[model samples]
Target chain A: MTDAAAPTRPIILEAALDAPPDLVWRALTEPELMARWLGASDIEAKVGRCFTVRPDGPVGEAPIACEVLEAEPGRMLSYRWRATAPGEAAALDTVVTWVLEPTAEGGTRLRLVHDGFPVVLQGAIRGQGAGVSTMSAVRRRQAPDLRRRGDGRAKMSSGEVIKWAA
Target chain B: MDLFDFDEAILEADILRALADPTRRAVFEQLARREMSVSELKAGFSVSQPAISQHLAALRGAGLVAERREGRFAYYRAEPQGLAPLIDWIDRYRAFWPERIDRLKDVLKDIKP
Candidate 1:
């Protein structure tokens, strides 16, 4: 809700689970446990292992593409979340981090961070584009205003004219 | 945020890619606060002037920045409205986690380890 805080603010979600850290870790890492809550995923905690997570049931968004960035048993897990579609150049690329802590009552306190406030969310996660093909179309649509200026100012400035894809 | 048009969606993707680099993101954030000429912006970073210009060019390409020429100097400033799509996108996603996590709590309570 606060934009003035930092350059890129990550989304943070927290949960206090009644289970212990090990049980919470199992739920976070085990495929079956994950399917029961999060999407279905591979349990291999090795860093750099890439996997796809499909929603447990038939109805949901497309499978999310992920690569493990770090893993600490019963403590933390982080992975890159890439949700791209066919024909898109490059789309949504965000990181999902799970941090677990043992509370005084022995329950597990978990923190989830999805970074990329402005850096990573793109058409990759939401949808796909034909890409590259639209540049000519954009130029054609913009010729009325940009070209009518008639001066080389557009060319002299910034090397190329840009539209908001508006 | 309806994003019915293909171009608009690509616009979001383009901006996302533009800001993906930490350095470039920093530059944009700096400009967002106030407009500055290339030299003024360059003083904040150790990269070569051309490297800074490249970053500015990328930011401009994505429509996240606007350049103003003041005599011999061109000043760059962030177009805050350009971030509307990103903020809107995040708003949509913000609702996702809590709902899912609530479900996760239920799952945790119902399931054995």
Candidate 2:
């Protein structure tokens, strides 16, 4: 869902996956598959489906409330992302839209759009979350992609690389 | 990781609490554009004068606003740096998807049918 009053730009992270669209789509949709990659989430690939994501990492964070907004098999997946930090009343509401395209090499081109951040601190803050206003349109496409190492190990990113707000 | 996470979480909580109120968020949006005295802010908002002061105080406490005094008037404006915690959160957040997506690659390799 977008904020009609103020359409803030989204955080886009694009990647070219070695696998085809169908495989990529499955990983994004199936709960069992999603857990392996997207932390612990009960995500389903149906529009209006509600789910929760509790990212498992070094530090445990609050679970994020999510609802699927658009689910197109092998093509797109979009969801509403609402997060409440521990002890906070207001939820940081945002949207996440994933678009997948098939490449000439039979790989999948995936694009993720995360928007609906508060723009109160527009100029000074630089979009970061649904506080997410300055991470504004941080396009991290060209440098990142899924690749395979000679040892057959899967490498997902090219490491931390971004030049925000130049 | 744990050491810094605690501090960041607290800062993030403060900012979210400060802006959680729609009216206060509105107050912030107004002050962010330009500096204004409490009376000036009151003219645009339906909230009481005392309520405006309270909102300003909340914003100030969160470090989302800075106060200025001119003659007898006190003015407040948005503090850009107050959003640092969020920026930190976003950095962690932005990193989240990619790292997960990265793991997805491995999952796909194993389960590719």
Candidate 3:
């Protein structure tokens, strides 16, 4: 899992499913079924609407506030994911998109991408060593000092953050 | 590497180009807060009316912003649909986390107190 480095570009992941495209589409758009796998109590997939996704076991924070960016029945869906609570480093909300194509074997080729990594990752790779231009130095260097600082300013726990950074 | 595997890259490039300009970025920031017309966008910044129009044109071309003609004025707002593909792509990785946690739970269960 790489931090999507490009501000405008998206990080893509693909999966080929044995199920038909229609079946996959239902699994994606149908909120009740999607919750079984994806978690969250209320999910409205319409464009311009808001949805809440509460994943179990604390991956980041609970109940991320999401705004529907786009949706095309049976083909594509996109939305913005952002932390709902305040006092967390104000981050540029990230975007996620999914595209489904019909494969030759009557299955679906699912393509997913999330764009807008925080500038800190790019700074880290560039050897800036300091945090992102926007983030506090403590947060920017949290990976190297996870054991020392477990104050929990970030949505993801230290272990979770380290695993994600890896 | 299959460079052309994702056309959303092309879409992203276009969005980036639209955002390259300072005025356009400010325009987007304004729209993020609330829908506004071309005149309203002009008011938010110190640029000339024609300059704001040019920025709006660029944003509209990128599909990052959409316009609707209401009476004599044109209203513009954030095109949330345009951003959907990017957001959904990121969430795909979230699926892997639970499995990893489950594995760690198993390891802990195996350990003696």
Candidate 4:
């Protein structure tokens, strides 16, 4: 995320990856690959596929239902996120978008954004197992592609080098 | 950015901006343990009631703290919910660890003679 300060708009969480644009794009759009990393649960992403992400605790049964918004090839993908609560309102639905850009060194700069999370669910996002697990799922799926080092290792992969340059 | 900007939902930037201040953070810290009145907050600092009010206004605007008017007293307390997103957002970055380590592994693989 560009930390230059959007000044109260939306808090952007962004990261650059060392994978090719297509690989990065696939990890986001392909259902199987997505499940390997970050699916609220197991899901298939199509223009109009509906899926549920089940939480793992005494919180009863909360299935996170979602509909795919945009799934352009190698460019962008988005979805609608909402809790399938009995009295849930339409206005409460959130949107998540993923944008991929090809960098100079053939790596993809990936941006994963969740735009509709309410001020209330902040609890879910807090290092809670579900939210953290979801984010980890996404990162792990992209790990092979990103392959960039943070703790200073001697050998750097080609993609890692490209990521550093980006 | 908005105090809840990290949340993508709530579009209240003033609240985050208000909390971004050192004085505001201090005020929040004080209010965390218990509810206190406007005058009570003012007593802890050298600034005037007007300044404290100004700070409280921003905090109130951000939803970081909510005020209840009980009779003649306006009591302020921490809105723990307001702070959760920031905590979660920061924690998400920590998820980067596994990926970073995996990247290091790939680098190691490349260097193997």
Predicted structure with the largest TM-score when compared to the true one:
2
- Give every candidate's TM-score on chain A: 0.63, 0.69, 0.64, 0.54
Give one digit per residue, the lDDT tens place, for model 3 in A1-166.
Answer: 1223333434445555566666666666666655555555466668998887665543344355678899987788898865323433223356767788999987677666666543212322243322223123333332233332354222233133311222
What are the per-residue Cα lDDT tens digits for candidate 4 across A1-166?
Answer: 1112222213233455666767766565555554444433655557887776543323343455778878887888777765433442331345667787989987666665655332332333354555455444544543434433574221332222212110
All candidates: TM-score: 0.57, 0.70, 0.44, 0.41
Candidate 3 TM-score versus the reference: 0.44
Poorest 10 consecutive residues by lDDT, candidate 3 chain B: B1-10
Off by over 4 Å in 3: A1-9, A87-92, A121-166, B1-113
What is the number of residue pairs that collide in model 4? 9
Name the runs in model 2 displaced over 4 angstroms.
A1-7, A123-166, B1-51, B67-77
Q: Please identify model 4 stretches exceeding 4 Å from their true place.
A: A1-9, A40-45, A54-61, A84-92, A119-166, B1-113
Cα deviation of B61, candidate 3, in Å: 40
Winner on TM-score (1 vs 2): 2
DockQ of candidate 1 against the true complex: 0.11
State the weakest 10-residue window (summed lDDT) of model 1 chain B.
B1-10
Docking class of 3: incorrect
Evaluated against the true structure, the overall lDDT of model 3 is 0.54
Candidate 1 residue lDDT tens string, A15-94? 77787888888887888878877677885778998887765443424466789999999999999876555555434567
The 0-to-1 C-alpha lDDT of every candidate, in the order given, reads 0.66, 0.69, 0.54, 0.53
- Which clashing pairs does model 1 show? A91-A124, A92-A124
Segments of candidate 1 deviating more than 4 angstroms: A1-7, A55-60, A119-166, B1-9, B19-79
The fraction of correct interface contacts reproduced by each prediction comes to 0.21, 0.28, 0.01, 0.00
lDDT of 4 at A22: 74
